[model samples]
Each structure stands twice: as structure tokens, then as C-alpha cells.
Target: MNDSLIFATEGFGLNLNLFETNILNLAVVVFGLYKFLPNFLGSMLERRRSAILQDLKDAEDRLEDAAISLNQAKKDLASAEQKAGKIRNDCKERAEAIRLESEKRTVEEMARIKQGAASDLNLEAARVSGQLRREAARLAIEKALSSLSNSLDDKAQDKFLRQSIKNIGDI
Candidate 1:
């Protein structure tokens, strides 16, 4: 009436049983691990791989966006630099033009001043020359009259007076 349902090998377990050694339990556990472990581990690995691939894809997209933004920023910076350079050149040209114009005006004003001074000098010289000529003529006329008074005899003076009077009457 004490029958324990344990199967035993005939030669190896002549006195031992499956319930004592737990060989049946060990076999079932080993068989279960062999049959199901690969599926469980493979599914877990596949999920992890998919998540890693998705993460890599997202990272790549973000990197591409960043690259585009960096390129646009570079272009904007270059455009701003070009505009700044153009403005600088325009300002330099304007400054040069203003300087040249100022120099030209100054030269023109100086030339006008020199010409005015020359004209005034010429007028003064002409006035002085005319005055000298009048003075010289007066002196010569006085010397001639003095000499004529000394050399003129009465007969000659009378003849000279008659001829001069006739010339005046004809004119």
C-alpha cells in the first residue's frame, strides 16, 4: 500500500528512484530550456535591434537637418560679409570723391584770386605809366620853350607866328 510512482532504470537505479534523484525533473527542465530559450532571447534581441535602428535613423535625420542649417547660416554670413564689403567700398569711394572735389574747389578759388591780383597789378602799372608820360611831356615842353625863347629873333618869331596862325585858321 506504499507505492511511490517513480520510474527507475534497472541497472543504474537498482536501489535509487526518480523521486530521490530528481532525474525526471532535471530532464524536463533541460528540455524546456532547450526548446523555448532561443525564441525568448531572439525576440528580445530583435526588439532591441529595431529600437537601435530607429534611434540611428532619427539621429541621421537630425544630423541632416543640422547640416542644412549650418550651410544656410554660412551662406547668410557670407552674404552679410559681401554686403558689408560693398558698403565699405562705397563709403571709401564717397570719401575719396569728396576729398577730390574739395581740392578742386580750393584750386579754382586760388586761381581766381591770382587772376584778380594780376588784373589789379596791370591796372596800377598802366596808371603809373600814363602819369609818367604826362610828366615827361610837360618837362620836355618847358625845355623846348626855354630854348626857343633864347634862339628866336624878332623877324623869325614874326614869321613863325604868322605861319602858326595860318595853320590854326586852316584847321
Candidate 2:
């Protein structure tokens, strides 16, 4: 009985020592984790937060640039539309001028053709009138000759002939 009691007391002491060792090891691990984990996690979180802020700033800058470019593009489009309108107006004016010029040229050409035709008609009329006058003169001469042949007789002719000979000797 006495030996069994000694053995039981030794076992109880060993259990107590093991419990103390385990408690000390748990405390050391807890202390080490408490000291190191905060710094590591804080640094990593700070880096991630900085990267997020930078990305946000970059997005803002890009948005501003896009807005500026959009405004410029709108201005350019408006200017181009004005230029196109001016060009269209110029072309219309030029076309109108050309049309007017063509009309004037056509009128002038018609006038010239009319004048030339009038001149040719006048010349033809003059030629026809001259031919008619010549025909009338030839008929009158033939009528006069026939009338003279009928009027004069043989006796009258001899008397008139003696009178012309006296007149010619006086001249």
C-alpha cells in the first residue's frame, strides 16, 4: 500500500508539470502571434488601399479627358457642317451664274441668226425687183418699135426726109 501511494504521487506531479509546460507554450504562441500579425496585416492592407486610391484617381482623370475630347469633337463637327453649308451655297450660286450666262448666249445666238436671215431675205428681194424691172423695160422697148413701124407712111416719109436734110445742112 505504501509503494502504491508513492507511485500515484509521482504520476500526479508529472501530470502537473506537463500541464504547466503546455500552458507556457500556449502563452508564447499567443504572444508571438499578437506581436507579428498586426504589422504584417496592416502593411498589406495599406498597400492594397493605396493601390485602390490610385486606381480611383486614374479613372477620374480618364473621365475628364474623355469629356474634353467629346467637347472638341462636337465643336469640330459643328465647324465642318458650317463649311459644308457654305460650299453648298457657293456651288448653287455658281450654277445660277452659269445658267444665266448660257441663257444670254442663247439669246445672242438667236438674235444673230435672225439678223443674218433678214439680210439674206433683203438681198433676195432686191434681186427679184431688179429682174422684174429689166423684163418690163424690154417689153416697153419692143412695144415702142412696133408702134413706130405702124405710124409712118411712104409719102409722109419722103416729106419728112426732105425737111431733115434742110435742117441738117443749117446745123
Candidate 3:
């Protein structure tokens, strides 16, 4: 076994100089990458963090603005509801006033009509009374004239006519 190990070593001997050169090259590349890549990667990571923070701040500002708008809208809606209630109350009051005015006018008109009717009735009664009195006087005169013509004799009628003519001449 020792002879075979010596034969394998002779076939594949260690090249220390080549190994040292490859190790030195690898160290240089690792050191170079460490010196420059970290700065570039750190700057990129910092920019990404700043961008994310800026986006978060913008989102927060937008949320605040939305909240403010929502509060304003609520206040506006409350004012609108109050205004609507006031308007409704005003309309009811105006309607009531109109109804009262109409009722008052109607009552006044009814009273005036009643008064006019009473006046017309009184005037009609007075006219009818005057006509009745005139008719009664005419009927009384005709009745007296008929009774006197039937009761009086021709001699008495002549005497009455002569006396009436003498009395008329004297007047």
C-alpha cells in the first residue's frame, strides 16, 4: 500500500507555486469586490429605503386629506339637513298663514253677504208696505163712492152738486 501511495504521488505531485498564485488571484478579486460592491449596494439599498419611505409619506398625506374631506362632507351634509328642516318649517308656517288669511277673508265675505241680504230684505218689506197702503186707500175710496151712489136719491144728489159748486167758487 505504501508503494502504491508513492506511485500515485509521483503521478499527481502538489504544485505549491500554482496553488499560491490561484489563491492570491482569488483574494484580490474578493477584496476588490468587497471594497466597491458594498458601497454601490449600500447606496442602492438606501435609495430604495428612501423611495419606500417617500411612498409611505405620500400615502399617509393622501389618507389625511381623504379623512379631512370626509369630515367636511359630513359637516356639509349636516348643514344641508338643518337647512332642509328650516325650509320645511318655513313652508309649513307659510301654508298655515295662507290658510288663516283665506279663512279670515271667507268669514268677512260671508258676513258682508249676510248684511247685504238683510238690507235687501228690509228694503223689499218697506216697498211692499207702501204698495199695500196705497191699495188699501184706493179700495176704501171706491167702496165709499159705490155706497154713496146707491144710497143717495136724485134730488139729494142735485143738492149736493149745487152746494159743492158754491163751496168751490167761494174757495
Judging by TM-score against the true structure, name the best candidate: 3
Better of 1 and 3 by TM-score: 3
Worst window of 10 by summed lDDT in candidate 3: 1-10
TM-scores, each model vs. reference: 0.47, 0.62, 0.65
Candidate 2 lDDT tens digits, 14-121: 334545459788888899889998899999999999999999999999999999999999999999999999999999999999999999999999999999999999
Per-residue C-alpha lDDT of model 1 across residues 53-169, encoded as one tens digit per residue: 999999999999999999999999999999999999999999999999999999999999999999999999999999999999999988987787789988887898799899999
At residue 29, candidate 2 shows an lDDT of: 88
Candidate 2 residue pairs in clash (backbone atoms < 3 Å):
none
Better of 2 and 3 by TM-score: 3
Q: Assess candidate 2 and give its TM-score to the true structure.
A: 0.62
lDDT of 3 by residue, 47-120 (tens): 99999999999999999999999999999999999999999999999999999999999999999999999999
Best by lDDT: 1
Off by over 4 Å in 1: 1-74, 153-171
lDDT of 3: 0.88
